[model samples]
Target: MRAVRPGSARDRPATPTVPGLLAARASADPSGVALTVHDIGSLTFEEWARRSDAAALGLIDRGLRPGDRVGLVFGENEWIDYAIAYCAAQKAGGVAVPLPAALPAGELRRLLAHSSAACLVHGEGRNPPHTGLWTATLAELRPGAGSLDDVRVRPGDAAQILYTSGTTGEPKGVVASHANLTFGCTADPRRRPLAHSRHFLHAFPIGTNAAQTMLVNALDARPGALTLPRFTAARFARLIEAYRVGTVFVVPSMAIELLNAGVREKYDLSSVLLLGSTAAALAPSVAMALTAAFPRATIVNYYTSTEAAPAQTTMVFDPARPDSVGRPASGGSLMISDGEGPVPPGTPGEVWLRSPAEPRGYDRDGDAPGKVFRDGWVRMGDIGHLDEDGYLYLLDRESDIVKSGAFKISTLRVEAALHEHPAVADVAVFGVPHPVMGSAVAAAVVRRSEVSTVELRAFLTGRLAGHELPTRWLVLPSLPKNTAGKVLKRELRTLLATPEGDDAAHSS
Candidate 1:
């Protein structure tokens, strides 16, 4: 409800435990504003540490023991409170599980049951019906009369359990250790891009992987972290000018919206020195547009997944190789393999990466044996290739690649080509059932203005091969997107299956 700006509080902690990190920050600069949720309120380092400490006491008071899982059900309004609960869980030697607030009731119930969560801590009015789990509000996690004892936590101890987005299948919980959660916490702030910014801006939802990364960036990278519970193109642009945001983190979808909204022309974004896009591949066209919008800023496209973090690719947009997602980061290794062994240079295959920060594996209840994890490497489930120089270039999700009669087409390549058209605002290329071809290329296009499918196909003639062009097309005002800004291709397939929208599909 209120915004408070505190003076410089410079305290850096070198602890590996989540609570130890907070304790160090609080001790260094207790009055520093650590987290800010737009239109809500903020928490100073001291306030965050104290409240979380009390919450830890409460967890202990409620019989939470080491390795116990505590599920968190909070939305944007409860970010600060969620942070407190997160630390409290770690301090009490418990594992914190952040549940997506937008999940359906059935899915939520399933996740809680699957996670074996001992206690559920939620925001005000955000609690769900429980058959057996203990439930409490963030405010209810109060300290008892007795002094709270510090629970010892090891670097190898499990600190958090993050569920996958389940785009391909059921969501599996990935267990991260304290060392994984605390990676880069002790890095020199003066050298990092975020350290120079007074305010860092991001709009990732609370329970997603990107949001967790932003939370760490808040504690280590920048002085204050600003967030938008809901994302809108205009609002995000204005926030930069309003707060003079120096560092920003976004996904490809948000970047596209900003370019299309033309908000950069309406706002003074000169304060922004660094803009980073992640969680999905950055379309080359969108990358170019970002560079134009923030001429004075360094635009970076980072490539990483929840299962393979710390080991990531960071690219500072070069015109020569705009599509490349950069090389393997320091102390990390990446390779492309075709199930048997490493593939030749420039061959597309599953992207496998090994990073010290990677989780040991998924929860025992989840599948991690030989499919996702094998030979000490995490299969990214992404289709990509490495250049002769070893830079990674992501094509598309292996699941979304279109398969025609005799050819496999990279949907991302087609989508990227479509984006180059002036009349096309957005596009998603996928596969659909065909009478003869078994599967044919189908595209869902969002145009800037009324345009005929015939005209669009003619435009892409030179850019894509004849077979790569869409045989079926649907022109919609916008593509269906999830909370994380990823297009829901499954829904698109379902939409095409219905005859009601059949008339909208145009053939080349």
Candidate 2:
């Protein structure tokens, strides 16, 4: 297949639909590399567009209708197929529901049932859950001489339903319109986002908000997108060297692992021009280490949620205000409220972000949307205060604060102090039941070198208040994390609640 030369086409899609984005890119540069999964194959814009069109035709033949939900279950190694299937769903005017391969069978069933998906499209060599829905493999979607010209997909039509990581509760399906997914896309390659790089890389798992953003980046950004089947500091570093990748995206957990494993010293990572951390706030210490590791790269931390996509705060790591997550980005607005109304700077309150793109919400019935979405703003469920200069500083998740007697301790503050220790590799702080204090602070720490709880407490004695220091400690091999890389504090709470001297009890 030959690629069309850039600037050869003058007519571009007027509306930014998912299928429209691909059509525009293919028309502009059909031969340009669109996506690559390392050690796996890649597809050019032309191949992606053609194959997805064929698959869309197959879906239409199988009785898929506009507004029908199609569940897409794909394995990590099947990104190429996943991309085609995703586009095909949109092209066929169906709502795509992407699910990660690592999801448990029961949870997968729950999501498919919740979405009321009409069919399931799965990758090769995988067993889709027994959902009683019509199912087919990617290979079964054969290419054919067919056209989707009659399909009536619109920018405002529902395009996909993505489930959250369920860090706090059962995952909620988030609905995004074609416009929401393709917001800010540009037809001009020279003016496209992330134009500084030839290629950008990430290891975010599929079925996540971060991964969905990467998919949109693949569709809208100037650079070709790259990912690995799995993430390890070694392989991630090697890809940077191999591709000389300019822009890299990661979560705080990945950044911590890279620093702990000393991958920066072992690999040539200077090719990275911009390093972005998302999913969770980067601990100040970790952010500083990343800056030192990627000496030439601008370390940026992005703050947003599933409901607040395309609306986030971008911080280019500033040592003076290391804890800030930056101000509301262009086309977005940030406000801190104390339930009744907006609060003054330096006063911690619930965080709300207003989206520049169309608002997204829980794809369920009843009061769910009202609980999180109000007017056009999304409740971030986080407690933070803005500095006088307008930079936002997160104190803790509303659910993560430890209530000890009369004091409300920020778990983030404790974790940040613990991270300052030379021997501390990683740490998570949460509240555990205490008859006297109601909830006492408990800490689970992963050590790089031998370090006692007594030492850790001593280290925090000056850095934290007496009530803020952890009374219970557990030295852990590693912190538990969901696929999205957010620490599973609920699991840690269960572990900490175990009786002392029990086989499973590591608490001191």
Candidate 3:
């Protein structure tokens, strides 16, 4: 092991404070056009700063306490508004909680309830429905008088609590401190382009990890960079073509949609220099597809949980060795351990990381926030193993794996097989109960049209090891997906909790 050089951090120039982050960008090139939104609008560093200051002053004067949670709700095409809210929250020493615009009233209410949010600064019409129980819209919230000057924030303080996509039940507030944001970003050598780069796109929502990463990148490298109001495959292509976007980041789902949407060829995207992918594992095929689309750009695959430090691992694409998630960045250490013991090379185990940055822990009781790490390392709930070369290869989730008799099965393997089926769109696999087989592999598949379990089973027979194949296949119009597009296998397991849950239940 390299024992992670503390010297590597020193090699980089002294990083400035959070406020300096924005100011440095403004000072570097005020009219440099920090941000651009194709067909929407653009913002200079001066404009972004002015709005940030206004929102900060507004948030402070509006009685927002330091560390208070301010819900920043924006509709599509309001990236500037979201940025304003984020900077303002930082200025006021408060945290910005970005809520997805698509969530319904009930789900929105649950988010507010869970967040214990006392104040909200939201755009009109963009406020999540039924959030009135707690959230307040921004336009309607007039400054209460003089609340600034009192909202100074320290480097170690948390800047936000980005909620997970709520694919399971509720989202957990993965915490990130200001320094954590700064350190995590600059540590990754991958961001060297961002050090003194051109304007980048923040097309995704402010609430998502992608947006958060973009925010830090903006503040750290080129301040006042532009971001799209929202992300759409067509709009993404247009933005890149028009703005000469140097970097474009998105999930495989969006990338696939863009490819299939026929817009990829419609735009002159030569300006796209880096294609960054994160959130969930991008199918290897999707990685290949991205390389094919952005021939001029470097395809970077980043791995981090809402719970871990950003860019903990990153792999720039090389078709010859395309599967790695890159080496650990300068800030953290990564290892695969069996909870108590270290695993051998190529053996899948839980991915654990240790970062000087990242939340010490979460606020479990709504007070006295706690750190979630043990000793120094944090448990990242992902199941992957390091190869002899230190490249990480992901297996299915440890809990999501299906154990049938003596063989342990990979749910992802089965899902990948189902995805290859002509009629299947998406699917979730699990192990329920079995008297004889110990546990039987079960599947819930979302199909395109009339498809039967027998047909699906027949489809998988030769493709999957007989024991690895799902015993039964149930068809549905769609499988449940959380905001981040992760499948809610936990929900499926509960819903199918009966032998019905295990149509492939062990032969009693």
Candidate 4:
């Protein structure tokens, strides 16, 4: 068996965490602008440093200490406040736990209970209605305070406990190290780490791992980076033109919203360059749509997760192969293997990655540290395979795979096929209970026009392989999605709530 991956680990350097990099960038560009919000005044690195210092000092004055976990519960654009909380936590030796703003109150209560966070810092009006707890806004933390000088912090120390939607349908927190965060943040150039990036835009509040990864990009180019507090597709288009924003991270859904909102042409987006797309796989059709809109930008699709942020893969780069999540980052490693061993070329298996990009571990699953975090491999429970030239192709999450009559079907493949149908607007595929085959393939879809099960099945007939088509169809106004926009198969499967025949005869 191949042990630790060659590149992601070999490349990790002394002081290979994020806080150190923040310190270095601040020193080199102290007088430079470091942060901003749309129409709001920007801050210089010196100012960011001072604000972060004051924020940290205020937290300390409130009795925060190193090693304590503080919840960073804020909206996407105002993550700078979270960053201040994060940096302050680092200065005082504490971990910042960033939680998504969308979790229902019930879920938030459970997660906060699990995280054991002592306090939280959010922008005004962004705090969760935690019912029983007292929350403080950044504005309320201190009226005016001076910045503190650099406070030493060590690498390999726990930095953030980033929560993710867990496999069992629970929200699990993944612990990321300063080493992992810093090393991965600086891995890309078009998306490099700078004290000042030309311009930045975030459509939501900073909570999920998606925003965390983007924050790394903004902080690297500090003082110059600015964000919108909420997603106003029209307003965002104007801000990009007004600020000459160059880099943006958006989900496919948000891209759809922007196009639907009719904002791209109203503003000059020519200045924007790096347009990164993730959180979910992009449809080739959607990619083409995006490509046409941002003719000057490369719409990059990458393989990533909450457990392992991003890495190289067991795939061959072939842009013509529209189904793939692009080539691996410059220095990353991956292997596709059936449960027992490595797979041969073209065969599918659970995709495993080994890199410094892997989150150190999760809050509850010590197994993630012991089994997944080997000398460095992270076993992301995603099913996929590699092509001949070394590129990764994701099939689906293991839990999302549909097994019927001895055949395993990837719902993502089915969704991709359905995406091409003219009337289909959105679709989600999952397994429904079946008395005959243990499970049956099912799909829930949103459509532009009323579509019958027969018409949809007829459409799928020519587009999909025999065993790869859905066994049942349900037309929904819209598929259910989590705050992050991931299709909630569990929710759909519940709505499906009954068995269906696994007979291939029913397939289109």
Candidate 5:
């Protein structure tokens, strides 16, 4: 193992800080391109570093000081500017908070109030009504006229606050430090796979955890990063060809869409060397499809929550163990607990994670007082088990698991089995109320062709046992998804609960 260098010497560079890292990159390769968004042009390492520094100075001039919160409201085309602002905030010694422009007014108000943000920054031609908060556009924050010194930010200082996507409940801000954001960047380059890719491609929105991670990877990894304003399977495939992109990042939903649409067949995806999926578990069938699509690429599925980031489990796809989400990576430890304490091996329970980089807690949330964080371990609220070899297998979110009759069913397992059907395009399995059985398994499916409920059941016969099968299936034109491509189970349940055929007419 390579020893991590200490920062005790005065001559050594200030690293691990977002601005410090970018400065180092620019110093190493001034002329190399750093970021490229097709519609918004590109930025070389030198240009990005210089402009970001000026942005820091501009923020400082605007009265941003240490520990102040600055919220960035960004559109698709504003990513480059957003990246600059992200570094600038930290450089100016302020905490940066990213707010998705698509958020509802009420949600936006809640987040701003929760983070105690001092200013809101918007992009070109965009103006979101402010609820008693200072607001500015990117165009107004021009580069400074002269040289400016970088702030000395400590490793443990507040870096960024990432809001959860609210799949399980209300959105909460996750507080990360400078150390949390820069955990893996100091690893030996010779042993890093990120160094192999000449270019990285992704379409994650600016405010997302996945996107923020990609931003750091672009700076720490090899070559440049390219992005698309909007993502469609066809557009994603086209970008791969246009840029000869060698590293690909996507959610499992997009992978299924690409497979169902046969988009890869239309383009030359041979340049892709690494494909990664996060946010949710990648179904085994989808993992196999990605393998076949990018024959030379290493397929990786990473498991982590917005709260448990920086500490995660990573697995390169093994066809034999496709159900596993890999073992815990460095800088983290994993344990399965059943309230009292650690559970026996092979027994399913809440997944607890311990890492040096785990978030302190949710900011200003009333629901945080609980057993979630105990003895420095974050109870992930996810239910999973470990095999004899220590490979972790995620079943489902504890709240998402279905109790039917005398058994508990994992929605993830059912969804994974359904994905194996050739005609199934997308699927979300959940539990709906059943008077007799306590709860029954239900599924919402999107089909590529004319697939009847009977046909799907027949296809799933040997793949799943009787109790694990989804008893109630609703075939819809498409499953409702959020910006991150996670299925809106609450909306699905509401749709199914209604007696009106208006919604049912659209479903089979």
Candidate 6:
């Protein structure tokens, strides 16, 4: 593994705002395809720029002012309109809040209220949850003839506010500045991360950090972003085969599904050069499987959170160190601390990342004690350690560490071990309530073939310690996941509390 080359100032975006990135790309390559929604349509950089500029004028006509918050609600299929709305808000000098359409009405209401969004722009066929907030459809925001010269949007100005997945608790709104979003963007296509690729494919849903990153890539990278209206393993595979896509990005769940469905066998995916997995650590077993599936592709795992984005760690799959998430990339700094200070190598502690870009924070959590953001570092809320090679190995989320009868267990380790079993297609290891102990390790497993608790326990005998082995087992058809393809552990805990879950399986 080689050290990530730090980007120089000359490599930074010439115009450091989201709107500016689009403007630069349009001017440089007006006729080049910018975004292509497979089976739907494609938009050139010039078209995207002109459409967004016109939408910005419409937003201003609709009473949007500098610093006004505009909530953007769109379906997965509405990425074209979503992109325009996202840029229009910034171009009109308003902060954009991209809300997932999958969210319940009440949850949407809560987010809109929290962000204090003055207006909401939604896509076709999407009903804006009755929030009483001023609303308009993308089409209704009629294009107007005017320039956005009056609005003074600076790189330091707030650009967007995205909420967390709320897997552990209430979703917190993460606010990012223009500089934060456009940190590594460049006018020179050669400097882009995936410049070697003509097109990169991803199916990350709208309102996700992954999707937002793809949007930025559409503007900054030489590759035209290719995606589906919605992601299905079959459709994703077909897109790659059809486009001969070189770069591909997916979350661990999507990768697991693709592997489970055996899409590689059906499609010619040999054209893929880079396979990036993000949102969560890719299980080593899954990563190795991908290497075989995409023979020439470099399987990379990216680690970052909604609260700490752009600042991330990228690991090019190294069989010798499969468990390591990797050292910090893109000039970011990482440290493992135990509350008081930095911990020694090989000692697990809270992981923190410091980025050269402007730090993002909870929208309303200003200087609150015990908050994730401290100084310039964003606490990753994950337990990990740095090896002598400076590679980060994640143990588990601090909240996911199972405590049973004085023993602390890393669920990630348990899950990783379980993933090695041929019968186990996917697994989620979490803590379940225990009367004797504070909590016991429990696993919700999705199997590729029927495998009893006895067989699984036998397989895990030497792979995991006694305390780390799950006492309770639950067989599932599929794991509950959020829009971003992250497992909803809280939902798993809720399911485990049910009587049906109690009778699923148990081994003591």
TM-score for each candidate, following the candidate numbering: 0.94, 0.95, 0.80, 0.85, 0.93, 0.96
Of the two candidates 1 and 4, the one with more favorable TM-score, higher being better, is: 1
Q: Model 2, poorest ten-residue lDDT window?
A: 1-10
2 or 5, greater by lDDT? 2
Candidate 5 overall Cα lDDT vs. reference? Answer: 0.81
How accurate locally is residue 366 in candidate 3, as Cα lDDT from 0 to 100? 31
List the candidates ranked by TM-score, beginning with the highest: 6, 2, 1, 5, 4, 3
* Candidates sorted on lDDT, descending: 2, 6, 1, 5, 4, 3
Output the better candidate (2/6) by TM-score.
6
lDDT of 5 by residue, 1-508 (tens): 1111112122213337777678878887788888888877888878888777877777777777788999888987778888888887888888899988898888888898889998887787886876798777755776555335546787767789889898888888877777778776753445444676778999998788899998888778875889989988998999998888889999988888888878767989999999999988899999999999988889999988777777789999998899999888886888998877888889999998766552445666633345565545677888999999999999999988999989989999999988888888999998888889998888888988888887787777898889877777777888888878889998878777876523552322
Q: Candidate 6, overall lDDT?
A: 0.87
- The collision pairs in model 6 are none
Report the C-alpha displacement of residue 133, candidate 3, in angstroms. Answer: 7.3
For residues 109-190, write the lDDT of model 3, one tens digit per residue. Answer: 7776677776767776663565554454544544556655555566666667777665533567656666667774342334
lDDT of 1 by residue, 26-145 (tens): 887789899888899988999988888889988898889888999988887678888889888888889999987888878887888888899899889864865378889978887776
Q: What are the C-alpha RMSDs, in order, of all predicted structures?
A: 6.3, 5.9, 5.5, 4.8, 4.2, 3.9
RMSD of 4: 4.8
Q: lDDT tens string, model 6, 1-508?
A: 1111111122233448899888988898999998999877888989899888888999998888899999999887788888988998999999999999888899899899999999999988877668988899878887566668788888878889998888888888888888888988887766877876889999998888999989998988888999998888998999899999999999999999899989978999988999999999988999999999999999999999988888999999999999999999989999999887799999988999988787787787453564577766888989999999899999999989998998989999999899999899999999989999989888999989989988898899988788888888888889998898888888888888888777775756
Query: Where does the lowest 10-residue lDDT sum fall in candidate 5?
Result: 1-10
The global C-alpha lDDT for each of the candidates, from Candidate 1 onward, is 0.82, 0.87, 0.66, 0.68, 0.81, 0.87
lDDT at position 352, candidate 3: 80
Question: What is the C-alpha local distance difference test score of candidate 2?
Answer: 0.87
